[model samples]
Target: MSWIFLFFAGLLEIGWAIGLKYTDGFTRPAPTLFTIASMIASLALLGLALKTLPVGTAYAVWTGIGTVGTALLGVWLLGEPATATRLACIGLIVAGIVGLKLAA
Candidate 1:
């Protein structure tokens, strides 16, 4: 249950992270609101997961999910570069996330 909460929290972290770009520096009202809502929900869910998960592991996993999702989305949607080295680093982050979950 805690892992489930953490997973969704991580997803919401991705939402809010990507939402920042759509918000256009808070000038866009709808995206700004969505971004704010995502931020609140993400933190709330993270708090819930923290009840059972170690802070270090949870934090790393949360940010790892966000970073990976955001980077992929940036490449797919924002026309960012998807270089091999960049992707390899992202893979390493994924490896670390998996390692942390296994350890936990």
Candidate 2:
């Protein structure tokens, strides 16, 4: 299930992104280890997913999902700004991801 692998890859992408925040420029050992582990896991799953999925489709979906998820996480959990323009852009990214999948 390449899509399943892609889903897990997306989740791990979120993990790695949050871990990067906690890593404090790599000064925090625990978060740094988490960052490295999550990165490995994310890449591993992405590679597996790519075995069946077209590379362009897989990559676009992976990155779109990861970016949107991470940006939302930042806004919600980390108190990052969420301007209307930013929200609109995020919506566009999601729409594009959906369009690509539809085309695929």
Candidate 3:
């Protein structure tokens, strides 16, 4: 389904984002390759999802999932900041994503 593709695309977006952190400005060959692969895969999946989903809504939800997922991964795996405000913002993004899904 388009929604399933979109979900994995969003997850791949998060993976590519985290991979970007490891790439070290593209100096690291393996991580850079991983990042590029994930990026391409994510975009391709997004395109597939767009075949059925509304463009604006799908895009917003995709980016929302990526943003929130990456933030959470950063905190949990990358030792990024975990302040209450940051968590609240992530929650708000989640709420918006849920709202968009519901509306769709």
Candidate 4:
């Protein structure tokens, strides 16, 4: 259940990240609201997951998932470049996240 919470938390982080792009420095009300909502959800889930998960490991995995997910979303949804180098970096992030989960 801790892992599940972390996963959802990570996904919420992705939501916040994408919403940030549309927030225009928080000037736009709707996107800004989304950004705040996602951030709250992410933090809440992280707090809940910490009840059973080690803090350092949980935090690392949480951040890793969020970073990679948001980067991919940027490429696919926002037309951010998915060049060879970027893809390679994304692959590395995935590898690291998976490795952490396995080794945890």
TM-scores of the models, in the order given = 0.98, 0.94, 0.97, 0.95
Global lDDT of each candidate: 0.96, 0.92, 0.95, 0.94
Tell me how candidate 3 scores on lDDT: 0.95
lDDT: which candidate is best? 1
Error of 3 at 33 (Å): 0.7
The total number of steric clashes, by the backbone 3 Å criterion, in model 2 comes to 0
Best of the candidates, TM-score: 1
Off-target runs (Cα >4 Å) in candidate 4 are: none
Task: Name the runs in model 1 displaced over 4 angstroms.
Answer: none
Per-residue accuracy of model 2 over 1-104 as CA lDDT, tens digit each: 88889989988998998889999999999999989999999999999999989999989998988999999999999999999999999999999989978887
Model 3, residue 15: distance off in Å is 0.6
- When 2 and 3 are scored with lDDT, the better candidate is 3
- Backbone atom clashes (below 3 Å) for every candidate: 0, 0, 0, 0
Ranking by lDDT: 1, 3, 4, 2
TM-score attained by model 4: 0.95
Q: Which pairs clash inside model 1?
A: none
Per-residue lDDT value at 74 in model 4? 96
